[model samples]
Target chain A: MMLFFKECRKILFSLTFLIYLVAVIGFYITQFSHDAEEKISQPMQGCEDYGTIAKEVPELLMPEAAEGLVTEYLSGYYTAYPIGFYKEVKLSEKKSAKIAEIITEITGISKRELDGFSDFDEEGITMIPDGNGGYTPVVKEATLPEINIPDTMTYERFRELMRKADKIIGGGSQYSDDNIVGNFSLVPKTYEDALAEYNDIFEKDKITGAYARLFCDYMGIIVSILPVFAAAALANADRKSRMEHLIYTRKISSVKLVLTRFSALAATLAVPVILLAFIASFSVAKLYPENNTDFLAIPKMSVGWLLPNIMFSTALGMALTEISSQLMAVFVQGALWFGSIMRDTELTGDIGRFTLVCRHNSLYDRNAFMENFNEFLFNRIFYTVLAFIIIALTIWIYSEKRKGGLNVIRKNIIGKSKA
Target chain B: MEKIEIKNVNKYYGKKHALKNITLTIDQGMFGLLGRNGAGKTTLMKTLAGLHQKKNGSITICGIPVENTTEIRSITGYLPQEFSMYPNMNVYEALDYLGTLSGMTRSERKKRIDILLKKVNLTEHQHKKVKALSGGMKRRLGIAQALLHDPKVLIVDEPTAGLDPEERIRFRNLLTDAAEERIVILSTHIVGDIEASCEDIAIMNDGKILWKGTVSELINNARGNVFTVNVPQKYLSQIRKNYIVTGMLIQGDYSTVRIVSDAVPDLQGINTDEPNCEDAYMYCLYQNGCEVQGGDE
Candidate 1:
């Protein structure tokens, strides 16, 4: 227990720990503080954009869906997210023809006619009279032939056909099942819709849960990348200070030593995050005392939503540091955090099953979170389990190092660097 | 009551042999391991410290097999050649931390740390940060932390390698005091350290033990073989090439040179001299057909 506290003190006094604390607190105060305040004051107006949500009502308007497909097919290129990475998938001639056929089936527009839709009036450098005084050069907008959707095609049937078209285009087109409806069905929220969402926040989440999700969203980003610094520094500290042999020769078992350090680092890194959670909860409570905010909401969300991120990052940092005996975990964890941030496009919805950072940035989206609640639960549990497993592996590696089996590589690396 | 026993212990770093068929017994006293750089002295010391496992043979500390590392480590204290503690910690804090690692209770650690700081002459600098201390002071603090648990065996590798003459003598005396009750293995390439403090000494080279006996026995092995000759300054280079020169002093037109040879050379003013540990060590390496020149000592 003394060793654990000593290790904690060592980390707390290190420059890396100070830098990490600054980054966490800086991110909280700068990014989320204003959002918390704004959320408290913004009236429940339905005109606010919640981004494009997929609606159950389907309308196969030829101008929106078909024109989009025809334009992409003519260009011979499409943007897609294959395996969660943005890729510009250029289709071959055969796939392009297949897409053209689907476009004709949906809108009764031939591929040749679609290609001939470009009508350009390019008389070079024409000047038109400006209302003020001088004349300004104007480029006239091109007009294309109008295309109409077949009356016999129902919205559901057109959707099925478009889904097939999306599959043929290799799955990142606007017509894909996951993206087709959201791409076309963006409607402004009605006052009734906004009132209903406000009522949902008041009744289901009770305002604290809503704010807690936002807090987790911002805190999750910081926790995912910052704790790694403290962990990697603590793990590599003994080797850097040339104190490994002295500590290894002590009577404490490797498991006990590793677990103590791991817990100490986790606890120390948790301090700033837990404090932020309290401050955020208090701000929400003080700003709107009539809402009867749940005081436990932020704390509960911090543990339930954000703790797994801290655990996984810190444990991975320890494992990687033990294996290489270097601070290589920072790069690996940084790359993982970057990937998670990139994949989170809809912060208010679609919580991924395995993302390191689970973002729900909105103040009130109980239904979207509830839809993926089971997967979110599984993700958290899986990360927690993986954190423990990696910690166990770290303990094993530490023991092997103590037995003088794993230090050969580290010594050779150090030797080469010195040479 | 505590003694370490070894039998044909061998250690290898991949294909390279580090410690070759080493067998020795260490009892309660100050034992010195004298060897040049890469002479397996550190390898042997580490093997005994339980930091490295031997590939073959067995080792036991006070009748407990070395494979039972927890028990072995509980009673052993090791100060590595390149040792340091957390630099941000003060001398007392560093010792307290390591004592915790050694599993000493709070009262035991507090009581022992106070005594060790005083014994290692670090009582006055107890509150100084480790990085703020000088090299010799840091080495002394290393000793203080190593002895915090009062283990039965203390393995100090090159404790006086970088200390000045005054600090070196003080460190030797401290080690001598530590050896009164437990086994102390002081490994160094500097012969003066062993000569000043150690009674039982072993000389090693090329991962093999070249000689092991009392300090007097080692000195006696090369007694008649060591000679001092006064030669002209021009003949100094020839004398260095022909014989193993342990030391040399330039005196105007004449150079006083100490050389080790099997027989007295046909040189004017050649006289047989009493061999010290350094001369004996050079003579031992020469007798083993090893190169003896280009040594710092």
Candidate 2:
């Protein structure tokens, strides 16, 4: 217990921990606190511009979808997110012909005409005379040609064809099943739909739950990447200061030493987040004093949702640092965080099971979160288990290091750097 | 009666043999291990400290097998060649932290830290951060932390490697004082350190112990074999190549040189001299067919 507190003090006084705190507080003040101050419910007047929900309608307008395809094909390049990384996939002639064939089926345009369609339509602009008697050029808006769609094909059939097109494009194009719908938006919700969502937020989420999920959404992004810096610094400090041999020769067991450090880092990193949760809970309570908000909602969500991310990142840092004796864990965790943030397209909808950062950006639509509650539970629990497993692996590596079996990590790192 | 016994201990770093068929018994007091830079002194010290696993040997520290690292570590305190602690911690805080790791009670740590700070002459600098301390002060703090738990065995590797002459002498005296009731294994390439404090000395080269005996016995082994002769400056290089020249002093047109050879050369004004520990160490390495060079100043 004394060792654990000492380790905590060591981390608290470290510069890396200071950077982490600044980032956490910076993110909270910049991204979350403003939202907490604005008490706009979905049914209120300005809700239309504030929240955008995913409503997967059973319709796909052919002209709109076809025009987007033609524009992408004519541009000679496609934007995709294959495997959660942004990739610019350039197609061969054969792939371009395949896309043209799909475009011909949706509209009456042939492959030749589709290829000839320009990216923009030019409009003539008149010159404007300045007060100094010199002529200034005024540029006109350039618009693309609008295509006409036949009424014979249904939306479902068009979706099936687009899915096939996405497959031919290697699965990350905007036409892919995962992203085709994101290119379009649902019609604005009616007053009834808005009122229903507002009621759900009040009855189901009980005011604080709605705000808690939003807090988790923003806090999750920072938590996913910041704890790693602290963990890596703490793990590498002994080696950096040339203190490993002194500690290794002590009578402390590897389990005790590693667990103390791990718990200390995890707990310390979670402190700011827990404090933010309390502040957010109070803000929500003050906003709706008569609504009888569940004050425990934010605190519960912070622990249940955000704490897992902290544990996994910190544990991973410790494990990788123990194995490689380098700060390689930071890059690994950074890549994972970047991928999760990029793949989180449905920010206000169902939480994905594999994403490191779970997003619920809205304070309404309790039904979306409820729909995938099981998967969200599994995701949090799985990360918690994985964090423990990684911690156990860290303990094993530490023991090996004490026995001098793992000195090759340090030797190889030093040798390569010196060489 | 605490002692460490090693029976044919052999250790290898991959195919490179680091300690080859080593066998020795170290009793309570200061035991000096003298060797060159890469002479396996550190390997032997780490193996005894339970920081390295020996391949084909049995080591028992006070009747506990070296494989039982927890038990061995409980009674051993090691100060590696690169001595450091948490740089952000103060001297007293660092000692307290390590003491907690050693499972000392709070009161025990508090009392022992004060005593050790005074003993290492670091009481005045106890509140200073470790990074702010000078090299000599840091080494003294290292000694304090190692003795914080009062282990039965103390293994210090190259303790005086980079210290100034004054700090080195002070550190040697500290080690001598520490060995009053415990086993202190001081490993270094500085022969003067061993001569000043150690009685039992061992000379090692290429992972093998070349000689082990009292300092006087080692000196006697090379007695009558060391000679000094004043030669012209031009012949100094040639004489150095022909014999293991331990020391050379230049005066005017002639260079007075000390050589460890079996017989005196044909040079005039040759005089036999008493062998010091450094001369005896070079002669032992010469007799073992190991490459001998001038001391690394």
TM per prediction: 0.85, 0.83
Q: Interface RMSD values for the candidates, listed in order? A: 0.8, 0.7
What docking grade applies to model 1? Answer: medium
Candidate 1 chain B: minimum summed lDDT over ten consecutive residues — where? B288-297
Give the per-residue lDDT of model 1 (tens digit) for B151-176.
89999999998899999999999999
- Output the worst ten-in-a-row residue range by lDDT, candidate 2 chain A: A46-55
Winner by TM-score = 1
Candidate 1 Cα misplacement greater than 4 A, ranges: A39-52, A55-192, A325-327, A411-419, B249-252, B294-297
Pick by lDDT: which candidate is best? 2
Name the runs in model 2 displaced over 4 angstroms.
A42-190, A325-327, A413-419, B230-235, B249-256, B294-297
Model 2 per-residue lDDT at B168: 93
| Deviation in Å, model 2, residue B129 alpha carbon | 1.6
Clashing pairs in 2: none
For candidate 1, write residues A122-236 as lDDT tens digits: 4246798898898999776654446678778788788887888778767755676656655665555556655666777777777888888888998899899888888888888
lDDT of 2 by residue, B1-297 (tens): 488888998999989999988888888899999999999999999998878888998999888998999988899899999878888889999999999999999999999999999999999999999999999999999999889899998999999988999999989999999999899999999999999999998888889989988999999999999999998999877887778889989999998899888887777899999999889999999899886664323
The DockQ-based CAPRI class assigned to model 2 is medium
